[model samples]
Target chain A: MNDPIEILLVEDNSSDAKLTIRALKEKNLCNNLVHLTDGVQALDFLFGRGTYADRQIENKPKIILLDLNMPKVGGLEVLKEIRSDHKTQFIPVVVMTSSREERDIIESYKLGVNSYIVKPVGFDNFFKAVSELGLYWLLLNQPPKL
Target chain B: METLSIEHSISPNFTKKDIEILKMYFELSKKYNPVISEALTADLADHPLWGPLMKQQTPEQRKAQNERSLAMQHAAIYEGKWEEYSKDLLAQGVMYAQMNISYSDWYELIKMYKDYLLPYIKKDFADSAEKAILYLEGLSKFIDFAMYGIAEAYFAEKNRLIQANEERFRAIFYNSMDHMTLIDRNARIILVNRIPSHYNKADVIGKSILGFQTAENVETVKKAVHSVFEQKESSVFDTAHLAGENKLYYSSSISPIYSENGEVNAAVIISRDLSLQKEAEEEVKELNRSLEIKVEERTKELRDVVKELESFSYSISHDLRSPLRAINGFTHILKDSYADGNEEALDAMDEIINNTQRMGHLIDDLLEFSRLGRAELKKVTVDMRVLVETVIQELTRVPSERKIDITLQQMEKVTGDQNLLKQVLVNIIDNALKYTSKKEHTLIEIGSYADGGNIICYVKDNGAGFDMAYYGKLFGVFQRLHSASEYEGTGVGLALVQKIITKHSGKVWAEGRVGMGATFYFSLPKPRK
Candidate 1:
C-alpha cells in the first residue's frame, strides 16, 4: 500500500514499451513503473482482478499512459471504463500512442484523459516527449482525490 | 325572226284538192298504222332514249299506238292551220318523252307512213304529175318538223339525268372530313373541301399547295405534284405546315384527274394531320435520351468513389506503416550495436527519430484530409475576425525566438462549420508564421473583402514566398517545392487547409513570388437569413 504505482504503461509493442521506460528512467521519474503489454491486463490491474487480485483497488497508479492501437481492449475503451467507474474515474490517464489520429485525441479527451501525447519517430524526440510527460503528470498535474 | 320566216316558208304546200287527197291518205294511214308502228320499233331499237323502254313494250301494242299517232299527225298536217299542227306535233314529242320513247323511233314511224302513203297519192294524181310531186314534197317537210320536236324533248330528258349525277358527286367532294383539294395542271388550287380553322377557304383556293409549306418541304411537295401530273400517277408525301404558333404534320396524297381525251388536266389532293402521332414519338425519344444520360452519370460517380477508397486504403497500409517500421527497427539496432552511446551513433539514432516524428505528423495530416470527405457540415454564422485571432494565438504559442506582428482587419460574418473553419485558419496562419521566421520582423495580415455574394478572407505574410510557377502544386498532398532541409514540414498543411475549406463549400487559392511574399485566400458564402 505504501508503494502505490507511479506510472502504468499499457502498450502492445515491446520496443515502444522499452523506449518509453528508458526515457522515464533517464529522467529519474521511474519509481514503481508498472508495464502491461495489453489493455486487458491494464484493466485487470486497475480493477484488481486476475493476476493483480491480491493488490488493493484503493492503491491506484498516479498516471496511466495508455496506447490506442492494442491487440485486446484498446486504449479508448479502457479510458471509457475508467471514467464510468466511481473508484477509478478520478485517476489521471494520459493517452500516449503512435497514432496521431484526431479521432483518438478527441475521443480520449471526451472520455476524461488528462493528457494526450503522440509518440515521436526519432529516439531523441521520443525520449524528450516521454520524459516531459512523465515529469508533468507525476509532479505538476494535480489529480482529483480518490 | 329570220329562222321563223324560213320555217314558215318551208311549210308543206297543199291546194284545196290536195287537202282532200291528204285526208284520204290519213284514213288509209289509220288502217296501216299498226304495221308502221311495228316497223318503227324494229328499226330504232338501238336508240339511247328508247332502247331500255323498247324491251319492255310488246310488238303488237307498240304497233297499234304508233299507228294512231301516225294517223293523227297526217290529219293535223293537212288541216291547213300550221300553228295548230305544230302544237299537235309538240304534244306528240312530249308524249314520246313521257313514255321514254326515243326521237329516232318517232322519226322512223313517220318515214314508214310516208312510204305507205306515197303510192296511194301518186295513183290518185297520176294524170296531174305536178300536183302529185308537190304533195309528196309537202309530206316530207312535215316529217322534218316532227323530228325537230322529238329531238328537243330527248335532249331535255338527258340533261335532267346529267344534272342529278353532278349534284351527287359535288356533295361527296364538299362534305369530306379530310383536306380535299382540286389542283389544275399548273398546280393551282381550284377547289377546297373544308378549310382548316387556321386559314380562310378563299385564301387557300387560288394558292399553290407548296405556298403553305416551308422552303425545304415546298420542294418535296412540288416534286410530288409534278410527278402526279407528268406521269399521270398518284404520289404521296409527308409535309409539315406552320399555322400561327401551331405546327401541323400531314400526309398528302395526290392523284391526277384526266380529261375526256385522256390527258392529265387536274389533280386531287387529300391530306391527313399527323401532329399527335409525331408529338408522342418525339416525347418518347426525349425520355430515352434523358434516361441514358442519368445512367451514364451514375456510373461515373460510382467509379470516382471507388478510386478514392482505393487510394485511401493505400495511404493507410503502405505510406503510414512503412516509416513506423523503420523507426522501430533502427531504434532496436541502436540499442544493441552501441550499448555505450557514441556521438555518431547517437546522431544516427536522432536522425531516425526525427524522420519517425515527421512520418507521424504526415499520418495525422493524411487522416484529417480523408476525414473531411465523411464529416457532415454543421453550419453556423462564424465571426471571421474572432476566428482569425484565436488561430493566430494558437500558432504563436510555440514560442518562436523571432518577433511577429499580426494585424487583424474588419472581416465579414460568414456561414460555415465553426470547427472546420477554425482548422482552415490554423493551417494558414501557421504556414504564414513558419515562412516568415527568417525575416527580421515577421508581419502577418488577416482580412476579408466582398466578392459577389461571398466573403473572400485572406491571410498575407511577409515571408519566404514560393515560385509562382509551382503554385499549382501548393494544395496537393505531399507536394512541396521546398526541400525538407529548408523547411520543417510534412507538406500536408496546405492540402488539409484546402480540404477543410472545400468541405464548407468554400474555395481556396494563393498568390506568391519567389523571395517576395505570399497571400492565401479563401472564399466563404455570406450568412443566410
Candidate 2:
C-alpha cells in the first residue's frame, strides 16, 4: 500500500484487463500499477474508502485508465467523484473503452477526462494502443504535484 | 252697364266700367265664337310647338275641344262664373304639364287664342273704334288672369315631383343599416341618418366628429375626413370605438358631397361595423395557435423516440463489441501459448478469431445502418458517372489474377447526399463484382438514363445470378440467396443500398436469373433546374 501508484487500470472484463496489463508490462510501464475490476473499487482506491480505507488518499496514481461500462458503479460516475474531490482532481484520467459512441466521448470530455481512446478489436491494434497510451501518460506527460 | 250688372257675381270687385267693357266683348265673342274656335284650332295644328299634339287628335276631337273651350269662356264672362273658369284653367295647366308640355308652349297657345279673337272683335266694332279698343284691353286683362292661374299650377306640380324624389332619397339615407352622417369642412356633423345607439341624435347632429371618436381613433377619422375635403376624393379607414361595455370595429368611407357650383361643401361618412368579422378572425387565430402547439408537441415526442433509438444503437456498438474483442484477444493468446506445433488447435483458434472479427464487422454494419436512419441528408448535385468510377476503382483495387471489366456509360446527374450516394454505388458495384467473380471474364456495366421525373441507374453483371423466385428477399437484411461457400457476405450490402436510396426519396430493385446474369437498378429524383 505504501508503493507509489504509477497506473490505475479500471476495467470489468478480465480478458481485456489481462491484455491491457500485458501490453503495459511489455513496455515496462506496469510497475507499481494497480488493477480494479469495477468503478466501486476504483473509487474506493482513489478516495481511500471501503476496501481501500487503509490506503492513503494523498498518494494518488500518476494516471487512471478508465473504462466506461463497469459493474456496481459506472465509469462516468466514478470520474465525477474523482473530479469533484480536491484530493484526486489533478490525477490524469484517460477513458479507454470499446465504445466509439459520440455521446460517451462527449460526456468523458465534459467531465474533464484528459483523453479518450476506443479499444481496437484486433489484438495487435489494441496492444499497440495500450502500449502508446502507457508510454505517453506514465513516461512523457507532465503532471502537477498531487 | 245695366245688362252687365249681376247679383251674386263671383268677382264682386269688378267696377261698372269694367262690367261695361266685359259685357260688350262678351257679346261680340258669343256671336263669333264658332268662327274664332275654327281659326284657333287650325292655328294650333300649324303651330310648331303644338303641331305634334294637335295632330294626335282627330278632326272631330279638335272641334269638340275648341267648342268646350269657348263654352267655358262664355260662362266666365256672361254667367259671371270666374271662380269655376279659373279652377278649370288650373286643372288644364296641370294636365298639360304632366303631358310634358313646356310653359312657353302653353303661353304661345294662349297668344294664338287672343290673336284669333282680335280680328273678330275688330270686325264687329268697325264704326266705334274707342269701344273696340276698350273691349280689347279688357279681353287682354282676362287672358292675363288665366295665364297666371296656369303658370301657378305648373310650378306647383313641378315642386311636388321634386319633393317626392327628395323623400325617396331620405328614406334610403335614414333606413340604411350603416351609420351615415354628413359632416361639413370643419368636421361638424351637419346631418346624420340613424343615430348611433350610444348617442342621442341631438348630441351627434351638430357636434364635431372628433368628439364621438375614441382617443385612439380620433386621429384616423380626422385624417379621413380632412383628406376627403382637401383632396376632393373619397377616403376610407378602419377604426375601433368603445361603446358602453363593448368595443366595436368600424370601416368608414368618407366621400365628398359636391355643391351645385362643384365645390366640396360636406362629406358623407358611411361606417360599417366589423366586430363580428374581427371576432371570427380572432377565433381562427386561436385555432391556428393551438394547432401549432399540437404539432410542436408531436415533434418533441418524435425527437424523443429518435434519441432513444440512438442510445440503443450506441449501447450495441459498445457492449456487443467488448466481448467480441475479448474473444478475439484471448484466442490469439491461446494460439500463441498452448497451440504450438498443434496445427488442429491453431486452426480452430484461427476460426474462432475469424468469426469474432466477422461479428465485429456485423455490429459495425448494423450500427451504420441504424445511423443512416437518423442522419440528416446533405443534398447536393451528385455526378453519378464519377461516383460509379470511383466506387469501381476502390472495389477492384485488391490484387487478383481474375480479369474484371467495368463499362460505365453516360450518367445523368441527380440531387442527393453525396456521401450516401457514394455508399449506394459502392454496395451495388461491390455486389456486381462479387457475383461475377466465377465468370471467366467478369463483365459489369454501369449506366443511367432519364425516366420521367427520375434518373435510373443500373449495374449489370454476367456471373452467378440468383433465381427470380427469391427476388422478394434480395434486399432484405441478412437475407442471402447464396450460401457462404458460394459467396462471402454479411447480407447487409443491398439492404444498406435500399436504405440510402429510400432516404433520398429514391427506389431500388434487382432482377436476376439463375446461371445467367443479374442487374440492380436504383432511381433518384432529377436535379431541379
Which candidate comes out best when scored by DockQ? 2
Model 2 lDDT per residue over A24-138, tens place:
9889999988999999999888887898999888788999999998889999999999999888898999999988877889999999999999988888789899999899998
Q: Write the per-residue lDDT of candidate 2 for residues B177-264, one digit (tens) a residue.
A: 8888899999999998877677887878889988877898998888888789889989888877778888788998999999989999
True contacts kept of 2: 0.76
lDDT of 1 by residue, B1-529 (tens): 0011113212445567656656654555566556555665676689575566788877767766665566556556555655545555555555665565566666665666677666667666789888666666555544556576555544654455456668887788777657788999778889887777878977798888778897669888888888988988898898888898877888989998889899988999898878876888999999999999999999899889966785664457334654575475556557566746677777777677567667766776676677676778999999988888788777778776898899998799999999989988888988898888789999989999988889999999999999988988999999997888887888888898888888777899999988788999999999997
Of the true interface contacts, the fraction found in model 1 is 0.18
Query: Candidate 2: how large is its RMSD?
Result: 10.6
Q: How much of the true A–B contact set does each candidate keep?
A: 0.18, 0.76
Residue-level lDDT for A115 in candidate 1:
84
Candidate 1 runs further than 4 Å off: A1-8, A27-34, A39-65, A73-95, A99-146, B1-347, B393-410, B436-446, B461-463
Clashing pairs in 1: A121-B356, A121-B357, A122-B353, A122-B354, A123-B353, B33-B67
Cα lDDT computed for each candidate against the true fold? 0.77, 0.84
